[model samples]
Target: MAEPAPHGTPRRYRHGPCHCDLCRAAHAAAARQRRRDKAYGRYRPDVDAEPVRRHVRKLREAGLPLPQIAALADLNRSTVSTLLHGRPPQGVPPTRKMRAVNADKLLAIRAEQWIGAAS
Candidate 1:
């Protein structure tokens, strides 16, 4: 026989097909958290990428290479490359949205700082 599902888990309420009190409470709590997150504007974790793309272009124009820009922005090298050149072959467009935290990080970099440092 299969082992019984653990108590106090939404998983038990869902896949376990168990509707016991603990499972129901867990499911309700999960639902409440989701509702609160949505109400607090935390549900959408991404922002439009256009502004970050523009900033990257500006930084490039200021003579900062892609790798350097990635380093300054504390982002992945591939992430900056993909933003500028897109994927290979099909050359997929830069993603339409990026995580809000990444966008903020990239946007925080100032082109003038690099331009001054490069000189």
Candidate 2:
């Protein structure tokens, strides 16, 4: 069985099934932080995948394999693959967005650095 969540926290109010004043305050505080971050442009959680997808394609065309691109981007091989070719059958569709951090990682890779290394 799972352990009980501690008090005086938003998690307690959410997962701990707590509705005490402390828990409510904690949840409200967390919400405020989120709002502030969004307002200040510091809460970029995701970004458009089109640019990253194009970069991945360019890297592949420049001789970097999927695994190499994944490693250079510090991402999973499947993630890189999914960026290029999404899940099929039911037509789940390619990724429309990706985590901002991940997009940064992928965007940092340059095809020039791996053009000859792929050999």
Candidate 3:
């Protein structure tokens, strides 16, 4: 008989005696990804960039300056300016709604750039 998990407690995996290389690597990778996501503020890749853009636009239409808009949006002033000027943010690529897909695409792009530079 299995012990009942405490209220609102998540069940732990019971991969008893299973110290496979693949599982270990997967766990390590997951931990690394979590750290990277936290460090890079990559929490939500597909956070509807349109909403942010629209917010900036509305603020601009309301006569707010670029700096004010940036402050309100918690973004850089140049980013707000670029968006107003119909340009994407520098250094960061466009993101899809699916976070995993967006992250994968970003990683792939970075990898390609690194490989190209090394070649």
Candidate 4:
């Protein structure tokens, strides 16, 4: 048996992505909790869109095609095109919701790319 953690210390390891029925139930429960947190606006992602925008701009500067950037980010061509060239929504009367698809993941992917480049 593993030794217990000190008081106020977080668990080093306990539950994880395992295949047993109990582990699967735990995984499902955690996922549901995450979804609920997101729905309730209680979860804030660590990365935002600025890094993604910077990375895309760099790629564009290097003359990479939109399709290439999209592939690198695991985003669709339309999304990469939109990210690069689409004007920000503005209106005196109205416009659509401001959510940018795949932006968060793009940020994460770009950060990872930077790490890889640095090393």
Candidate 5:
């Protein structure tokens, strides 16, 4: 037999200020919209994957522990362990090197322009 909810048992509040019936419905709808947006990459940050992988490799080469590497890289410790052990980190997509050659070229151009202006 199912036990009835205790008297005056408070209902769990959703994640918003207003808790009226309409407000609750609106909040639920908004939460679903946010989830959809995240799924479609509308609300996600662009994470560069290669840099994270490189950093993980470097940390492993430097003899850093998994916990230490995770703390320094802002990654989960389990992710660090997986990377070190030659396994893929869960839910982390590989990132491309966005500014690899372009960054160097831009820096060189800026340095030349700075020298010309200074001279």
Candidate 6:
């Protein structure tokens, strides 16, 4: 169990308009912890994702939205958005590199789609 707030601190300054030093320090520390947690789970995509990037670029050029691209790529909309916007992939642990298998699979799907489009 934890000790209750002193009945005046207002619980880390998040509740209302308190500007006390304690609240400010607590808020800053909480912000830092949030940032660290976000970074810790960030997944760095392959810098050399040219093949998939190019494919995604073309699909975007064709005016296909993220959900459509994701459906065609057989991936999640978030994954397609990360590839489309060139953001680092998220939701995977930083210690594990983004899976090459997924990228390769996208490339293969892109090729298949292109071939199908031609015919």
Candidate number of the best lDDT: 2
Instruction: Give a tens-digit lDDT track for model 5, residues 1-119.
Output: 21222222222233223466666666677668668988987754334445555655654555555565455445455444543443333343333442233222222232233335447
lDDT of 6 by residue, 44-93 (tens): 34445656777667766766666766776677665666565533343432
TM-score of each: 0.60, 0.62, 0.36, 0.40, 0.32, 0.40
Clashing pairs in 4: none
Q: Which residue pairs show backbone clashes in model 6?
A: none
Select the stronger candidate by TM-score from 1 and 5: 1
Candidates in order have lDDT scores of 0.81, 0.82, 0.45, 0.52, 0.45, 0.57
Candidate maximizing TM-score = 2
Residue-level lDDT of model 2, residues 1-119, one tens digit each, is: 22445687776899678999999999999889889989998887779999999988888888788898899888877677767887575365777899788899999999876875646
Root mean square deviation (Cα) for candidate 6: 14.2
True-structure lDDT of candidate 3: 0.45
Poorest stretch of ten by lDDT in candidate 2:
1-10
* Residue-wise C-alpha lDDT for candidate 3, range 6-119, written one tens digit per residue: 222121112232335655555566668778988999754444445445554554565666665455445545444544453343343432232344223322332233335447
Steric collisions counted per model: 0, 0, 0, 0, 1, 0
Give the Cα error of residue 87 in candidate 2, in Å: 1.3
User: Candidate 2: lDDT of 75?
Assistant: 80
Worst 10 residues of 5 by lDDT: 2-11
- Cα lDDT, model 6, residue 15: 45
Preferred candidate (TM-score higher): 3 or 5: 3
Candidate 6 Cα deviation (angstroms), residue 59 = 1.6
How big is the positional error of residue 4 in model 3, measured in Å on the Cα after superposition?
54
